[model samples]
Every structure is written in C-alpha cells, then in structure tokens.
Target: MSYDKTIAQAARTELERRRSQAQETARLNLEGFLSRCPRAVEIRRELSSNASEAARAVVSGGEVRMELEQRKARGLALREEYDRLLKSQGLTRRDIEPQYTCPKCRDTGFVEGRMCDCHRALRRSIAYRQLSTGLPLESCTFESFSLDYYRDDPAAMKQMGIIFRTCREYAENFRPNSANLLFWGATGLGKTHLSLAIANAAIEKGFGVVYGSAQKYASAFEKERFSREAGEGTAGDLKNCDLLILDDLGTEFPSAYSNAGIYDVVNDRLMSGRPTIISTNLALDGLEKRYSERFASRIVGGYAMLGFKGRDVRVQKLNR
Candidate 1:
C-alpha cells in the first residue's frame, strides 16, 4: 500500500532513533567498562587497529595469514593478562565488551536491508497517531457515555441504552474484518463520540485508522478535484485504511464533485469488504436524498446500524 511520504520518513526516522539508542547504549557501557578495567583500553585500541589491518592483510597473500597469526597470538596474550587482571579486580571478559539490546538485529530495526516487522508495526501506529491528532477522541469512549441524558421516557431510555451498549461492544471487539456500522442520530447525540471511541480501540489494537469529518473530506475532495495533477492524492488511503470513521455526514457543502467523491470513497470501501463506521445525522430517507438510493442501500444492506436517541449530552452535562 502507498503510504504518505511523511509516514515512510517517520518510520525511517524511528529506525534511526532506535539504532542511535543502541549505539549510545554500547558506547556508554563500553565507556563504563573501560573506566573499571584500564587495561581494556589497550586491548580495545589494539583490536580496532587489527580490524583495519585485517582488511589490509586481505591483499597480502600468505603474509596475511602470518599477520593474522601474530594478531591472534597477541590477542590471546592480552586476553590472558586481562583475565588475570580482572580476576584480581573481580570481573569477566564480557564485562568489558559493548552490550547490545537485540543480539539478532542489534536494535537496527532491519535485517538484510529489509524493514523488520517491528518497524512496520511502528509505522502503522505512528500513522494512526498522526491522523488522530487534535481529534476529539477522549470524550467518546463507552465509559463516558451515559443513558441518563436520554430522558425518563422508558422507550427512549431503553432504545438509547441498548444502542449505547451495542456500540460499546462493537468498539471493544473491533478488528480489520469487523462488520461495518452506521451511527445515525441528531447532532450532539454522541455519534462522533462513539465513532471516535471505536477508532481509539482499533488503533490500540495496532490497526491503521483513518478518521475525518464530512467537512474535512469534502474540503479535501474539492481541493483534489480542482488540482487533479498538482498534488498528492490521499483518497486511496482513505478508502483503504483498516478502519474508516467518517463523521458528521450531511454537514459538508453540497456539490456535484464532492458528492461523487464521497460516494466513491464510501462505496469502494463497502464493495471491498473493508470495515467503515459512518456517523450521520441524516436518516435513511434523508441519506437517499442527499446521496443516492444505491449509497443508502450500501449502508443498510449488510452493515449494522446503531441508532443514537439520547438528548444532547453536552447540554445535559452542562445543566447537571
């Protein structure tokens, strides 16, 4: 999949950070060990020089073997002296070598020039974090949702309570192949909150989540529509994210271009069997009027619908 350049760069930056950390640890430990065993200073310098000489000796034919033998003899003698010296000081040979966090990859986040699994996972996590920045995510968790705001009306309370529970369960068990969901309700009724809660959960599971309000999507679509070849396109990523949460549908300025673009993104995801959670104030018929009959069908066809019926939580909370 094509990720944003910033995503790939962030991944590389993270790998570099890990590598630097590993190197720093090695340097710090080496420095500490050298401070304890002053004789290791000589052996370290000699070994470093031998490493360079070993490369040069590769071109010296049989003389390389003779040089290698001499280096080996000297190394053995140094090791013996160091051991005896450490015995007196109470330390081992390993106590003087550079220590690594990962012996297999050495905290490089790669092997054979290919990215490691840890690196890929980190990139996906970073991407989700990047996308969700400044989004109102914390207010929407199931724990924050309350049914008291629905009113004492038994039917409304029961319906809203069930809806709230269903949304909570859905978000709790969310996965890439999880079922699509529609959150239909009036504004301030917790639609965005629940969708964001699910997004938070999905991201916690290491899934890549894409979230944008209808206004944001429409604005981007309009910009992309006008500048077809002028800039990068993010539409594909929107349609292909592991979980897509499109909030505040029906709020964007209506336009032919944005209308089609919106349909394409939602429809493509639906057809591809990718999970999407759309929170719209528009009811089924209103959805048909603003979008299309086919689009409305796509939402209700196989996807589950959660109807939010509570009064404005913001208003009720403020009053309380």
Candidate 2:
C-alpha cells in the first residue's frame, strides 16, 4: 500500500488540523463550564491535590496503603460531586472533552504505532481528488460505460464487451508490476473512458495514479525544459506513479522535445516494470512515425493492446 509522499504529508497535516481544532474546542468548553460554576473549579483543584498526595504516600512508605486508600476515597468523592454538579447544569463529561473526528486515533492518523484505517482512507481520498482535478473521473466509471452505444453493430458490440470485461478485470487485479496496456482506435470509441475507469479502480485500491492527456503532459515537459523551476516535479511524478494513464497520445503538438519527453516517460516506466495505460487514436505505423520505431516497438512488445471498436459514441449521442 504505497502512497505519494506529498499525499501522505497532506493527510498528516489534515489530521494535525483536526486534533488542534478538537483540542481548542475542548478547552473553550471546559473554560466556559468552569466560569459558570465556581464549585466545579474547587472540586477540580481538590482532585489534583488528592492525586499528588497519593503519589507522595507511595514514595514516603510508612502507612502507605492506608494513606493511599484515604486519598483514593477523597478523589472518588470529589469526582462524584463534580459529576452531580455537571448534571445539575445539564452537562456531561463528553460536553467538556475533545471530540475528535476519528476517536480511535484521536485524529492522530495512527493507533498503537500503526497507521489507522482512517488515515489510509484520507490518503486515498486526497489522491483521487488530485487526479480528478482536470479529468472526468467520477463519470468515467465501469458501471456507467454503456455497451448500448455499439448495439447497432453486432461485431462492434461483441468486441467492446470483451474489451470492457478485460479492462475491468485488469483494474480489479492491478499490481505494481502489472502488465502495461495500450488503448488504440479512433476518437470517441471508449478508449479514454476505459483508461480513466482503470485509473479510478487503481486509485481506490490505494495505488498512486497519474492521469492526463498527452498534450497536457507535453506542455509540462516543454515548459520544464526552458525554465529550471517550471514542472520540476512533474517529470518525476509521471515516471514514479504506480499507474500512469496518458490519454490521446497523438494529440500533442509535434516537437523534438515533446517527443523525447514522452519517450522517456514511457521507456522509464517500462524499464522499471511499472504499469501504464495509454490511449491513442494512432495505429502502429502512426505511432512509429509520430514518435520513433523504438518507441512503437517498446509499446507493442510490452503492452497488451486493446483495439477499441465502435462508431464514435460522442457523435451518436449528439445525433440522438
């Protein structure tokens, strides 16, 4: 269960904020309660003194058992009086205590030296939100992808059904070293939709996924080349994410730098044995011509090719 460092840090920061807010609220509640009832303050002081005296009795030794018993009785009496006073004021202990969002960990993101489930959930949510920033992740789930679009053509419908099942199974069983995937076909044939669907599943399973269009990535790479600070971390993220989805692969503006950038990212991930899913409107020959023979060969040899088949779903929808 690996997560991006930035995402883990963000989760920690959020947990810290929750803890602070809970503590602050608790302090204000206690302050207000003490202000309303002066007797409660006296009882609180007596309870503290009783605890100190019990500790001293243990160290002093003579008649320690008896002295400790007396102090314990005094402390219990003080607590009972405090509780009765709170009841009179229509309050309970919880009303003056910190109310943490995750009580099991007290908003600390951990329990007994281990990461809590709440923390893991928070990281997954943050990762998903970050990936969905410019993408339609919520709408591109497997359940929402309709086979009805290809119903008119029997051949197209059969092919799409198999492709859909394969993509869903791949996502369900995805691992760090899972096989790479290439989605190749014409526009609006459900390539990008399935790619994002896979991304959504991988993220839900706690894998870091970087998803974006090839054009967007190319622009980031080109900006990084000229400016030292621009997109400094973008290349690293692209290479290191557990799953990378490069959508519309042939849509980027043609340039030497963008070509090299795309090649580097694809080659690096392949060499590292990390899984990647790329959707392209280009075929083998088009990929070879647009990038290079080597780039095309790497993808062909390493990726499980899924050739999308169907009329343009977008066009079909618009016409309808």
Candidate 3:
C-alpha cells in the first residue's frame, strides 16, 4: 500500500529513535553495573589481556595449542565470575544488552534485506496518525455518541439507535473485505461521528485507515494535479489505505478532474474489496445529478445504505 512520504519518514525516524534509545539504555546499564561491581571491570580487563596473550603465543609458535587452551579456560572462568557478580547485584547478562523494540529487526526496520512486519505496522500507524490529524477522533467514539440528541422524535431516535448499533457491529467485525457503507443524511446527524468512530476502532485493531472530508481530499488532488512535487500522489494513498472514510462527500466543489478522481478512488477501492465509509448530504437522486448515473448506481447498489433522519443536532446543542 502506498503511504504519504512524510508518514514513511516519520516511521523511519521512530525506528532510528528506538535504536538510539536502546543503545543508550544499554550503555547506561553497563556503566551502572561497572560502578556497582568494580570486580566486573577487572574481569573484563583480564579477559582482554588473555586475548592479547593468546595472539602473542600464536605469533611465537611455541606450544600455541596448549597456550590457547589455557587462555580459553581462563576466559571461561572470568565470564563465570562476571555472571556471578551481575547476579549478586540483581542483574543478568541481558541487563547490559540493548533491548530493541522489534526483536526481529533490532529496531533497524529491515531483516535480510526485506522490510520487517514491525516496520510495516509502524508505517501503517504513522499513516493513520497523519491522516487523522484534524479529525475529532478522540471525541467521536461510540461511547461519546448520544441518542439523547434524537430523543425529541421517537422514530429518529429508534433509527439512530439501529444505525449506531450497526456501525458499532461493523467496526467490531471490520476486516479488509468488510462491506462498504453509505451514510446519507442531513448535516449534524452523526454520520461523520459514527464514521470517525469506526475509523478509530479499525485503527486500534491495527488497520491502516485514512479519514478526511471529501473537500480535504479534493484539495489534495488539486495540489497533486498542479504541483511539481515528485512521488506525492494523494490519490494513490487514498485508494491503497486499508479503510477510507470520506466525510461531507457532496460538499466539495465539483469539477471534471475531481469528479473523475473521486470516482476512480471509489471504483478502485470497491474493485479491490477495500471497505470505505462515505458520509454525504446527498440522496441517490441528488448523487445522480451531481456525478453520473453510473457512479450513483454503483454507490447505491454496492454500499449498505443508512439514511439518517433527525433535526440538526448542532442547533439543538446550541439551544440546550
């Protein structure tokens, strides 16, 4: 999957930071151990001297095998003594070794010339974090969503409860092949909230999610279309993200390029079976007029449609 360059860079930086931190921790641990047990320092010095003496005996060629065996036995004894010292101080050999975040890669982000699973997960996390920056992810969780807002109308409340339950279930069971969702409703009907909540849940489950308004994506497309920046294709990131949530779909300024771009993203994700959630103020008929009959039909037929009905809760909140 394609990722934003900045996000990829952030992941690399994180791996580097982890490597440096692990090394620093090991350095500090060794320093502490030496300070606590000066005998460990003497043992290490003796081991080094034994190695130098073994090299000298090899050069002298006088009973080198016997000399090497004696040096090896002495080195083993010193190692045992070092371990005893460490154990006396409530430490082990591992205590002075670098503890990498990813044992597979040792925080190097790669193993045997291939990207490690930990590195891929880090990239997904960075991409999700960068994409979710301006979104109200923390506040838009299922727990924070209120059925109290629709209480004035019983039918609205009931439908909203059902929608809320379905959305929660969808997020709970979310996978790469999960069903697409089309949230069609007026503004302030909690479509964005539920979609974002799904994004949050999916992200917590280690899915790569990209959530943003349709207008925001359109602006990105415009920049990519006109700019000279290399390898900065926003459409690729949107299409390849594990889950894409597009809010206020009908609010973006319509143009031939943007309309086609949006269509391509929707169609590509649909064809690839990558689940998407689109929250829009447009009905099926309105969608047909704004885009094309084929695009509208594709959405209406392929997506699990949820028509939200309620007064604008933003105004209600203001009055309350």
* Top model number, lDDT: 2
lDDT of 3: 0.89
Write the residue-wise lDDT of candidate 3 on 147-264 in tens digits.
9999989999999999999999999999999999999999999998899899889887878888878898887787678773655477888888889988899899888788888999
Which predicted model would earn the best TM-score?
Answer: 2
Tens-digit lDDT track of model 1 for 106-187: 5576778976777777777887778667886666677876777777678878888787778778878877788988889888
> Candidate 2's residue-wise lDDT over 1-320, tens digit each?
12376798899999999999999988987898899999999999999988998998899899998898889889999999999988888888987899999999999998999999999999999999887887889999999999999999999999999999999999999999999999999999999889889999999998888888899888887777766553445778888999998989999999999999899999999999999899999999999999999999998899999889989999999999
Output the better candidate (1/2) by lDDT. 2
Error of 1 at 299 (Å): 2.0
Worst 10 residues of 3 by lDDT: 1-10
Poorly placed runs, candidate 2 (over 4 Å): 1-6, 112-114, 230-232
Candidates' lDDT values, in order? 0.77, 0.90, 0.89
TM-scores of the candidates are 0.78, 0.93, 0.82
| lDDT over C-alpha atoms for residue 311 of model 2 | 95
Which pairs of residues clash in candidate 1, taking residues 3 or more apart in a chain or in different chains? Answer: none
Q: What's model 1's TM-score?
A: 0.78
